[model samples]
Target: MESKKKIMSEKLPITEVNPINSRYYDYAHFTYPWHFHSQYEIIWVKESTGLCFAGDCIERFGPGTLIL
Candidate 1:
């Protein structure tokens, strides 16, 4: 049998409410590099318009966009 290791992010944020937490980020520009975490993330683009780079896919997202 073989096992695979998922890519971990060095920029993993420190959640005050570990196990579950949420917050809004307003940035003048996309500041995060392509990264992944051990947990799932639900992101809602409230403002600004730009492209999203996920694993093996590229997408355009804007206000009211929801990502899971």
Candidate 2:
């Protein structure tokens, strides 16, 4: 499947304002759309509970959860 290039926000918390575009999210659920990027992306679930879908794999994620 061909992935899409998402253009994240540039205003601080919306997206990484700095050069190395890595940002933090503090919310209740995983609501971001299922998309992909050329740059490596990492997700660290600090709180709450939800499911993560990657390709054909589906896993439950919660506090202390990290995905790359």
Candidate 3:
């Protein structure tokens, strides 16, 4: 959110890099704490799985999943 800020790295395969909106890149994993923002968010997960927390919605997600 807030203009889509992404923290990126390259320790792993680029495809492994979680996507955030129109901007795309090849990088590593990312993490975000429980929080909120004003902008819209788009996320894609590939080759990985984890729990997602969005505005009190808590659930487990797997690869090839998209969240917004």
Candidate 4:
């Protein structure tokens, strides 16, 4: 079997959290598909709203919530 590789992003500073992560999607929303990774994630939304899916739970989140 051939080896497959997953794309990885560089470490970002604390000030550039939202825009850096939000760039995953474009105006049409036909960006990268749903996927999971081994690393644990924590997202912070500043002046924005969107949907979140973690494991089996799905819901809308905003600027003050923390997801695991």
RMSD of each: 7.3, 6.9, 11.3, 7.8
lDDT of 1 by residue, 18-66 (tens): 6676677778887765568666778888888888877677899998998
| Candidate 4 vs. true structure, TM-score | 0.46
Candidates sorted by lDDT, best first: 1, 2, 3, 4
lDDT of 2 by residue, 1-68 (tens): 99886744333333355446665676566666556554555778788887787656799988899887
- Which candidate tops TM-score? 1
CA deviation > 4 Å runs, candidate 1 = 1-8, 11-17
lDDT string, candidate 4, 1-68, tens digits:
99876655545433434433333322333244456765456655454567887778998987687777
Q: Of models 2 and 4, which has the larger TM-score?
A: 2
Count of backbone collisions within predicted model 4 = 0
TM-score to native of every candidate shown: 0.65, 0.60, 0.53, 0.46
Q: Which regions of candidate 3 fall more than 4 Å away from where they truly are?
A: 1-28
Reference-based TM-score, model 3: 0.53
Global lDDT of model 1: 0.75
lDDT, model 2:
0.67
- The global C-alpha lDDT for each of the candidates, from Candidate 1 onward, is 0.75, 0.67, 0.63, 0.58
- Candidate 4, after superposition: displacement of residue 43 in Å? 0.8
